[model samples]
Target chain A: MTPLRIVTQLLEIAAALIAAPAFLGWVNQCRAWLQNRRAPSVLQPYYGLRKLFGKDVILAENASALFRFAPYAVFGTMVAAAAIIPSMGTGLPLSTAADAIALVGLLATARVFVSLAAMDVGTAFGTLGARREMMVGFLAEPALLMVLFVAAMISHTTSLPLIAEGLTTRALALYPSLAFTAVAFTLVLLAENARIPVDNPATHLELTMIHEAMLLEYSGRHLAMMEWAAALKLFNYACIGFALFIPWGTGTEAGGPAALMLAAPLLALKLAVAGAGLAVVETLSAKLRVFRAPEFLATAFLLAVLGLLVYLLLGA
Target chain B: MAPLSFDLQLLNGCAALLLLLSFSMLSQRRIVNLVNLLALQGALLCAATLLVAVRTGQGHLYLSAVLTLALKVVGLPLLLHRLIRRLNVYWDAEPVINASGTMLIGLLIVVFAFGLAQPISALASTATRSTLGIAIAVILLAFLTMITRRKAMSQVVAFLSMENGLFFGAMSATYGMPMVVELGVALDVLVAMLVLGVFFFQIREQFDSLDLHHLESLKETE
Candidate 1:
C-alpha cells in the first residue's frame, strides 16, 4: 500500500480509538443532563479505561484459551471495524477491503467468539446469555443484510466509501427506500447494541440483562477491553450509519491538509449530535421483556421487507 | 457463435436440471424421498458450480463447490435423514396442498420467474444469464414448498435447496460472489443445519411428529 493511504488509515484508526471513550462520556453527559442531574466529566470513560489497563487481571481456574483470547479478538474486530467505517472521510487505505457486507460479517464473527467464550465457563447464566445472544443475532442478521442491500441498490456498490461518496455527491433528492431502511437500521442498531427497548445496558439485573449477563464473569483489564470494544462497536455503527445516511461533512477525494482539518470537527459534531440523539432514544423508550424481543425484531424485518418492496415496485 | 466451452455447457445443463429437481422436491410429499431428492439436487448444484469455476478460473467457486458438496450433499441430508428416522416422520400425513395443486402453482411461478428474469438478463452481461430464470424458479418453488409442506424437515430441506438456487444464480450472473461471501454463506448453512438439527429434536420432543402445522399454533392468535 502507498504510504499516504497507510497514513490516512492509521489516522482514522487513532481517531476512532481516542473518540470511543469520549463518545461514551458524551452519551452519559447527555443522559445526565436530560435527567437534570450533574453530569460526570467528559473524561470519565478515559479515566476508567486507564485505571482498568493498569490493574492486573484475575482468571478463573477453568478459563480456557478461548476465554483468555476473546478480549483480544473482540478488541481486534472492533478496531478492524472502526478502520472500515468512514469516521472522517472515505479515503482510507482499508476502503478496498471494507465492504458493507464484510463489516456485518466482522461484527458477527466477534459475536460468535464472544458467545462461545461466554459458554466455555459452563455457568448457567453464561449459557443462558449466550443462547439469547445467538437468538438475537440470528434474527438481526437478515434485517441488517436487507438494510445493506437497500443502500447498495441506491449507490450501485457495496463499498462503504463508494456509498458515502454517492450519497453525498449525487442528487440531493430524498429516497423513500433509504428513509424506511434508516428507521429499520436504527431499530436494529438499538437491538444489536443492547440499548433500551431491547436490553438495558445499565441494568445488571440477571433476568433483564443480555449483553451484561455474558460479561458477568469478567473483571479488570479484560472487562475494560470488552467495554472499550463495545464502545468502539457503538462508535463504528454510528459512523457507518452517518456515512451512509449523512455524508456531507466528510472529506472528498482530493484530500489535502485543509480537508483533513475540516473533517475532524465535522465528525466530532456529528458524533455529538448522535450521542445526544441516542441518549434521547434510550431515555424515551422502555425496555421490553426478553420474550417480546422477537416481536420487535419481527417488526424490524417487516419494515425492511417493506422497504425492499418499495424500492422494487416504486423504482426508487 | 462458436460452441460454448464444454465446461460451460455442462454447467448450464446442470443448472437447468438442478432447477427442475428443486421443483420436483417442492411438489413431493414423502419426507424420506424428499430428503433423497434434496441430496441429489445438492450434488447437481455442486457439480454445476464446480464446472463454472473451472471454466472461469475463479478459485472461490471451487471452495463454494466443496462447501455445497460437504454441507448440502452430505452433511444436511444426513442430518435430515437422521431427523426423520428419529422422529418417525417417514411420510407427511397430508400436505397443505395436494401434489397436483402445488405442482400447478410451481409451474405458474416458473412463468413469472422467467418474466421477472428478462430485465435482469438484459443487464447481466453473462453467458449464463438465461439460467437466471431457472434460478428464480428454483427459489420460488422452494418458497412454495415451504408454504405447502406440512413436515418441518421438508421445509428445512427446501430452505437449504433455495440457498443452492441462489448460489447457482450468483454463479451464472456474476461468475460467483466474492470469496468472503461464499465462505460466510457456507458457515451460515453449516450453523443453520446444526441449529435446525437440534431444533428437530426439540420439535419431536414437544409434538412427537415433524409436522410443522403444530407450529402454526405458535402464532399469537387474537
Candidate 2:
C-alpha cells in the first residue's frame, strides 16, 4: 500500500532470488563435508546458473506454447511465494493478499504447470517423472495442509504474518502439538523438495530421478529459470517453516530501514542452521525405493493428523 | 503440588502418545518392532501415572507407576524378546486385513471410543478423565490387533497391549483400581504369560509353525 512497504516487499523478493542458489550451494557443501569428500565452493550454484543462461535453447519438435510458458510461470509463482512469506520481516503488504492456503495454492500451481510441460515433450522419462511428481504432490499436499491447520488453530489465524506475530509476541511455552507438526513439516519439506528418502535431487539415474527427469528436455535459459525456481521454492519452504515454528528475530513492526537491517542477519543465521540440518538428514538417510514413497508420505500424513488430534485433545 | 494445568497437559500428551502407539502397533508388521512399541507405550503410561500421582498426592499411584515401569516396560518386553528368540518367529504372516485398511478401521474405532466416553468423562472427576476416550481407543485397537494377527506371538503381544489399555482406562476413569486388585491383575498377567509361553512351544512343536490359522482344524465337524 505505502511506498515503504512496497520497497520492503521488493527487497524481500530480490533477496530470495539472489540467496536461493546460495542456500542450495550451502547444503551441497555441508553434505560433501559430512561425507569427507572435497567440498565445492558455496558459489557453485550461481556459477552453474550463469553458465546455463548463456547456452542455446533446445525445444522438442512437438513442443507447444505451454512448454515455453511453464518455466516462466513456475519461476514467477516461486517469486510470488517468496514475496508473500515473511523471510526478513512479518510486516510485508503482500502477506495480506495471501494466507497459508494461498501459499499452498501457489506451490501447487507451479507443480501442475511443470508436470503438464513435462508430459508435453512426449518423452518416456518426462512422462514417468511427471507421474511420480504428481504422486508425491498428491500425498505431500494433504500432510502440508494438516500441518498448517494445526498451526492455524494454535494462532487462531491462517495468515502467515499474523501467525508469525502471534507466535513471536507470546511467552515461549513448550507446545507438544507444535513439536509433532514440526517433524511432520520436515518430512513434507524433504518430499516436496526432491530430497533424500523421497526423491534424490542429486541423482540422474534415468529410472530414479523425479524432478530432474521432468527437466531433461529443457535447456539454456529455460533450464536456468527452472533450476532457480526450484532453489527459490526450497528457500520459500524454509522461510515458511521459520515463520511458523521459529518466528523470533523476524521484525513484527514496520520500522524503518534500521529494523530491516537488523532482521537480515538473523534470517541468515536461521537459514544456515536449517541448511546444515537438512544436509545431515540427507546424508544419513538412504534414498527409499520409489514404491515405498506412498508409505513414507502416509506416515507423514498420519503424523500431521496426530498433531491435530493432540491439539484438539490436549489444548496444547 | 505441580500446577493442575501442567499435570493435565502431561497426562493428555501421554494419552495422545498411547493412542498413536496403538495405531502404530496395528499397522506394524515386524514382531520385534511391535514389542518395542509396546515397551514405549508402557514407559509413557508409567510417566502419566507418576504425573497424576504428583498432582493428587496419591502414594499408591506412585507405587503403581513403579510397578508399571518394572512389569510392563522392563519385564514384558524382555520376556517377549526371549520368546521371540526361542520361537524363531520374526515377521508376522500377512494380516487378514492389510495394514492401511486396519489403520482406517482403528481410526473409526477411536472416533467411536471418544463418543462412548463422553458421558463417562463428564461424570469422572479425576484430572486425567479427559483421556478416558484415548484409553478406550487403545484398548479397542489392541483387540483389533488381536483379531487380525495370524501368528500366536503377535496375538499374545496384542493381548498384553489390550491389558495396557484396560489399565490406562481404569486409571483415567477412577484414578486406578485398589492396590490389591492392581496386584492381582499384575500377577494374573504374569501367570498368563508363562502359560502362553508353554502353549507357544507346544503349538509350534505340533504344527511346526506358530500360525494360528492351523487352529481352525480343531473345530468339531459333522
Go through the candidates in order and give the C-alpha RMSD of each one to the true structure: 17.6, 2.3
The DockQ scores of all candidates, in the order shown, are 0.02, 0.36
Give the per-residue Cα lDDT of candidate 1 at A32.
87
Whole-model lDDT per candidate: 0.81, 0.90
- Whole-model lDDT, model 1: 0.81
Determine which window of 10 residues in candidate 1 chain A has minimal summed lDDT.
A306-315
Candidate 2, residues A1-316, lDDT tens digits: the string is 6676777788899999999999999999999999999999999999999999999999999999999999999999999999889888777898888999999999999999999999998999999999999999999999999999999998999999889888888766667778878888999999999999998888776588899999999999999999999999999999999998999888756567777888899999999999999999999999999988988888788778878876775567
lDDT of 2: 0.90
Candidate 2 residue lDDT tens string, B87-116: 999999999997667766876787788888
Please state the Cα-based DockQ of model 2 relative to the true two-chain complex.
Answer: 0.36
All candidates: TM-score of chain A: 0.96, 0.98
In the range B87-135, model 1's lDDT, one tens digit per residue, is 7778766777765556557666766877798799779887777677778
